[model samples]
Target: MVLPAPRYRKPANDLRPALPPAQRSGYTSALASPGPFTEMEKLLAVTAIGPDRAGLVRDLSEVVTRSGCSIHESRMMALGSEFAMLMLVGGNWHAIGKLRERAAELQEATGLTITLRDASARPKVDAVPYLVDVVTLDHEGIVLGLSEFFASRGLEIAEMSTRRYNAPHTGAIMFSVQMTVNVPASVHMASLREEFFAYCDAENLDAVLEPAQR
Candidate 1:
């Protein structure tokens, strides 16, 4: 049986400090600057979520640069109809109000739901045990198929990676995913293996699940 993602999440107890009011102007100025963020610099976290489509990244990049911010750490995921981006940007403008206005403008232009907030709002995620790796050729229904597999078995994915393969001859697209999952003591490892392989066979994708040696 297949199920939707279980809303699996990290513990909420972990906390991060809020961005200081004094850092706003400096952030704005740095974004206006024409360079990458230095070690000593700070960044504003900008997020955008909506239907996945063309030019989402390009449009956001242009809007952010125009507002004087430089993207540093970026994480993006496209799940069917939804697309999400988390960008750590370094700049001198810290006025969230201005950032909010700019995000509104981008939304008007792209029909995207955009948000600008201090990254500190999200809680920190502590390290955990158990990792899952899955490698496969690129195709539709990949993420959802595997996500369902994890959820059905009560596993939570902490992080995952997927990309297209660039082999000169084969030129096959691939997805390499590494995730951390919670294992209940009662679950049988062999049964989980059977389930994983069964799904992989049906989907015509190569997948492997094992205890992380590290």
Candidate 2:
């Protein structure tokens, strides 16, 4: 007797079941259409310093716009008589290249010292955020002391700003500090605060350590 023809079978890896006629057409169309495509962004850290002048921001912004780059985050301030800018810009690779090429022109036209460097996105931190505010008589090593205190505890200072100004009534030169620190989740909040306050007391720094509000 003739042997029966071998039965047809799909390969084990072919797990997807066959679709109906209309469904098959739709599925094929979906596969053919390009889904959402997002271009990978390149980052650049741009810093510029120049004499305080009107239209400085305008000029810098114009260059970025023309280069097809956008400033993602920026800090612009007048430090004494000089204007300083720090920016995190994002764009495509070509856009970033264009921006880099224009840096010299921007420096020459705006009288600013410009610097650019490739930057990566900030990594997420698994820690609690606390705000530290300190006001004391202006003296040497205030920041150094505060930084050392946190550093010893393995805390990270995410952002910090310090300023010196004359007291409104007494005309005394006073220093003020504001900082956002990342405290590890494993740290005991009460103990840390107590130690920080004690240290502040010993150093004559009037300080407030509190949880940062979102």
Candidate 3:
């Protein structure tokens, strides 16, 4: 007896036609398929915090590198006994997926809290840069008072570092603040200086304000 003709089965790939040239999503490399990177159009802001220990940076960085992404910028520091790190990572789609998938693994291995988010391009600010230095007998309200002083003037504090120490000869406690502030170019420098010093005098503190070198 003649056997019935075997039924034909279409291959899986044959069912889906190639993406049309114009209809294809721009995110994909070509009209054919997706890969690690099609356009490299995203930036990821990654933040992590963990107990300070040796090889923490190495471990985190290895994850980024092994996944074929680069750490464009990173800031790592020991805050008290804990370590904090912030990194700006750039990668294509697949690379980003790898980073996300492996984040949990990293957490388990290193015990760090890691977060990832999309980041926009940095905007430019035209405000003039200035350095403000203050030194006085250590006391309460120094930082609050200074912060209020700048806020009143609508100045932006880009960065500030404060320290307390004993005076070299007298052994008296001293506090100092060094801050980088952005002042609008429209402000009159001479008059502003006069006004700032007047406030410092009233606060019983010494201050010096001047342009910051690039």
- Summarize candidate 1's per-residue lDDT along 45-107 as a digit string, tens digits: 778888988889888888777777667657777877899987776665463445567889889
Worst 10 residues of 1 by lDDT: 8-17
Higher-scoring candidate on lDDT, 1 or 2: 2
Candidate achieving the largest lDDT: 2
Pairs clashing in candidate 2? none
Candidate 3 residue pairs in clash (backbone atoms < 3 Å) = none
- Model 2 segments more than 4 A misplaced: 1-39
Candidate 1 lDDT at 109 equals: 83
Using TM-score as the measure, name the better of candidate 2 and candidate 3. 2
- Candidate with top TM-score is 2
Q: Over all chains combined, what TM-score does candidate 2 have?
A: 0.80
Shift of residue 10 alpha carbon in model 3, Å:
85
For model 3, what is the error of residue 164's alpha carbon versus the real structure, in angstroms, after optimal superposition? 3.3
Alpha-carbon error at 191 in model 1, in Å?
22
TM-score preference between candidates 1 and 2, better one? 2
Ranking by TM-score: 2, 3, 1
